[model samples]
Target: MTASVVLKFPVFTVTEFRPLDRQIPKNHPSNSVKTYLPLKTPRFPRQVKARTTLMEAAQSGSSVNTSTNASMKLLFVEMGVGYDQHGQDITAAAMRACRDAISSNSIPAFRRGSIPGVTFGQMKLQIKLGVPHSLQQSLDIRRVKSVFPYGEIVKFEVVDGGMICSSGVLVEEMGDKNDDCYIVNAAVYVGY
Candidate 1:
């Protein structure tokens, strides 16, 4: 027999459980050492919700459909930087991830329904870092964040006879140069 597994992190996941009450020896190894006891665990569910990328905000932002039967590919790009208080390149992982995603086999999602003049749609995705990593512990980078005062959603238009199309972009940024930290800007294009 075979089994399927889904894994999520940080809370109430496969390995998360509250400890049950049990007596422990007074002389434990650590000061907080109460005892090595089993936790109150719930029975494994025979079934669970199976929707991908809907459980949390981060999942929604970075979600990808994995069904191999469909020829279309949907992709998202992410880029950011970690800055110390001094503002030097703490990390550049975000830029690398975004670059790989855009250059890989994934493409952006298109309009599901049709419009009068539109036959297909194109999307350009980008992620920019505004804050230093020193403050990152407080923010959830995995989730979508609207740095703008209001929300923004890019629109796609699939116009007629779109045999060949071209796109162009320039990404640049300027911040406290004296701080000398890393700020990541990334771009993505999606098509099927």
Candidate 2:
């Protein structure tokens, strides 16, 4: 005698049977039944390619040349937020944001040679900053690039983002200029 079992799921259905003492032949056609189910394909957001080159000079003290070609593969991304409560300097906020993003991360893979054929000097970085639209012209791109210690800066872009709100206090001595505070967001993409 044989015992048969059938299981059904929203995505698929399976049917099979087992004998009391003997096992069914592996190549038997009727031994099992499999039904294919229609599945919806998953959708993913599009990736942003690096377009603009922010820095061409080697500021990180490394002599290795960095390539900004489209062939590079992105490994990961780090995000952070920063704000300037005084002086109303948007560049300061942007630098803080970049520092905040990379401060907590440790990339041993590059130094340890975990990525085959990739060296620490060969690392590539792309930075995207979000600043208030009104203060875009005031952003100092060169000063902000100083925050990065290593890696080749391939792409740097500034888009309208972040926020502006009252800090509730304005002091002439503190260089407040005004009570308004400037906030900036940074996204750093790391790759080889």
Candidate 3:
């Protein structure tokens, strides 16, 4: 008879515990939910409001303080026309146009400090120049700006409308000969 042997093995099993609930700290960076403070919009003063008040005053027949007002006034309007015939010198014509614009009227607005937040140096000039289309390229912008002697913020705008007169006068005394006259018209606005 042969010898016989017997062997036996043991089995094991694992069980997991229920997940524990805990409070998340407010300072925790990993928290998904967040709260933010409300912000305020800024406010600014409007010129329209002041003008409305001024209008009210006018309606009520009350004297308004025009001196300290920040409103810009139309001081004067001057119209001038210049001609350069000999060389088709648009700059010279523009200079003469500007001179003609200011020649008739004097602006004392710069001398008055009654207006609030305005000064002589802060005088604003809006210059509108009308020149022939052919002479627009020949006109020097800096030469046009140099015509204003006082310190001013000049806004120059050139448009395509003006008279180009026919000239018969010779280039006499170093002036336009009247062969090809370049006409320039100007409108100057001076204000704070």
Candidate 4:
């Protein structure tokens, strides 16, 4: 018995009908031949054009306008995740997340005059937090703001995210109201 297989593509189609139990004889002309097909046009015309444009722009050092303030150019972004296993404090988790994000980083570009016309005093930061929906009200924005030692907070947004799961054990002395553990994610965008 033999089976037929058909493959369809935007540029071409292929149909193969071969024996299931036996291979084609080695002496057959089809067994020793190969075919190469040339494409008349690109399969993804827009993608090819866009990629070339992006490469040219990048090579020319052209910056893209992303921030609302045209003067503010994004330097880098730091991300971190924190969780409160013992206590059900969302703010504590958020603070820890922020700390974790910036702890390992030391950015001296502003003070060192790495960026032309920019100074440490002009540094701006945008903080985005992910917290559970139910615990959004309990999050202390002021306390979270205090985590940053410097930088002017230009934008702050809180979206419904993060997770609440069991910590496996609840200790009354540790202020665990329940066995629920609160997790928070933080993204700090640094720009000037």
Task: Compute each candidate's TM-score over C-alphas.
Answer: 0.23, 0.64, 0.55, 0.71
Number of clashes in model 4? 0
Over 4 Å off, model 3: 1-74, 170-178
- Model 3 clash pairs are none
Over 4 Å off in model 2, which ranges? 1-69
Q: What ranking emerges by TM-score with the best candidate at the front?
A: 4, 2, 3, 1
lDDT of each: 0.34, 0.84, 0.67, 0.84
**57-116: candidate 3 lDDT, tens digit per residue:** 656756456433234443445688877767668889899998888877766656677656
Tell me how far the alpha carbon of residue 116 in candidate 1 is from the true structure, in angstroms, after superposition: 17
TM-score top scorer: 4
Query: Which window of 10 residues has the lowest lDDT sum in candidate 3?
Result: 1-10
lDDT of 2 at 185: 99
Candidate 2 has what TM-score?
0.64
Model 2 / residue 82 / CA error / Å: 0.6
How far out, in Å, is residue 120 in model 2?
Answer: 0.9
Clash list (residue pairs), candidate 1: 83-133, 87-180, 87-181, 88-181, 108-190, 108-191, 119-158, 120-158, 121-158
lDDT of 2 by residue, 1-192 (tens): 877777787766676666767766879865656444545586768976864323322333233334334655667788999999988989999999999999999999999999889999989989999999999999999999999999989999899999999999998888988899999999998887
